[model samples]
Target: MSGLTNNTPRPIDIRLHQASRLLEIKFDNNMECQLSCEFLRVYSPSAEVKGHGPGQEVLQVGKEDVNITAIEPVGNYAVKLTFSDGHNTGLYSWDYLYDLGRDYEALWLEYLGRLSAAGIKRKES
Candidate 1:
């Protein structure tokens, strides 16, 4: 996980990698984040993406090749990313982004488990 704190998410610099479906974000404190298309899709902050709460976050599959089409700011506190597959509802807040970057591994593992339980595979078979 990156050294993302409140200070780290203060100013976010985002870059798009079309070929690999990766979005790289650099924070104020120089914390670089290389989030994959699938990761962003699955971890989207939208109500539609996050679901109602824990245990409801739907497993997003077949998004490994998805690309970030656009990045729009949501006021002054967050960002909205549009994917090539057409999902752009999520508003990723500074706090949420920092938390995700800080606890990337644990949350990612938890997501993997949930996917397994739901019998949804990440990569194409």
Candidate 2:
């Protein structure tokens, strides 16, 4: 399936491995990514985390122990992720998820930099 952009691909499969604390997503184009719950939590697309505008994103710290408690489809375009920390507002669109997967490394490094700049440290469980 095609997505929002011409290059984006729709997700074909999604699996949550609670024991491994990972969420795996496979797209129709055969590209796949395995993301940790901690990463998802910190990069949540919700207003509570991402804020309403650019430069307003709240730096999410202490989410190393966080886990996704549920994944509810929000129609054919997105899924609402419920975090164990009580965050469930972000509706992860197909495009957004694909971007997350494709840009995991850079995004993660950016997150780490933000944390470091903010003098925050992730708390491991």
Candidate 3:
């Protein structure tokens, strides 16, 4: 995953809606997205999920009901999310978050494909 770039739009506001299990973020560039907690958890930038290099991605499973327990800011560039499943290693930078929102459909579909191919059925949320 890429880090912050010169044109990366910073988040103007970040709100966690616990009841809805969504993270609503609005960027300075007028872009906004509501990302599900499950989506964020599975796409976490942590080494445990992303691995150290290419083709080493560890497919996350059974995270449909996972929710964010905490959101701690790391400097001005990123936020560290603590999930209910105890995952708190990923530093979700602004650019990464933006990309995730921008590419959500494709990423989510890919994840679903992987799960299907592995014969892993996601629990209903």
Candidate 4:
């Protein structure tokens, strides 16, 4: 069990820009992704962020100022995000990250709509 598994990544690159709150992920297959901090926060894979299931996610609010504090690699296929807001349980897999990037716009709007419905405003930092 000491040896690496067959699925061990040959290569993957994740670049984070603190000023921009953006992550640029380059896959081994040549696919590239650009993701925003807000996008990543709402789509966090942690139960506190995502809830137990669909339709149960607790809407993340007041997070307009949140930023990634660190990107810790998990094995070969995922990374753990340490957020400035103190959330670090979300284990973001490559597949999940890809889906988040692909569905960014719709998801973000939905989240904003939720905020509006709850009378929550993102405070300026």
Q: Name model 3 segments beyond 4 Å from true.
A: none
Residue 93, model 3: lDDT of 92
- lDDT of every model, 2 decimals: 0.76, 0.88, 0.94, 0.79
Best by lDDT: 3
- Please write out the lDDT profile of model 4 over residues 16-79, one tens digit for every residue: 9999988888766676778888779877889997788778888887788789999999986679
TM-score of 4: 0.82
Ranking by TM-score: 3, 2, 4, 1
Residue-level lDDT tens digits of model 1 in 1-125: 23434454565577788787777777777777777777778788887866887867666767767788898887877888888899999877776776677677887898889888888777762
Better of 3 and 4 by lDDT: 3
Clash pairs, candidate 3, are: none
lDDT of 3 by residue, 1-125 (tens): 56677888999999999999999999999999999999999999999999999999999998988999999999989999999999999999999999998898999999999999999998887
Provide the lDDT at 1 for model 3.
53
Residue-level error in angstroms, candidate 4, position 10: 9.4
Query: Sorted on lDDT, highest at the top, how do the candidates line up?
Result: 3, 2, 4, 1
Clashes of each: 0, 0, 0, 0
What RMSD value applies to candidate 3?
1.0
Sliding window of 10 residues with minimal summed lDDT for model 2: 1-10
Model 4 stretches astray by more than 4 angstroms:
1-11, 123-125
Model 2 per-residue lDDT at 14: 98
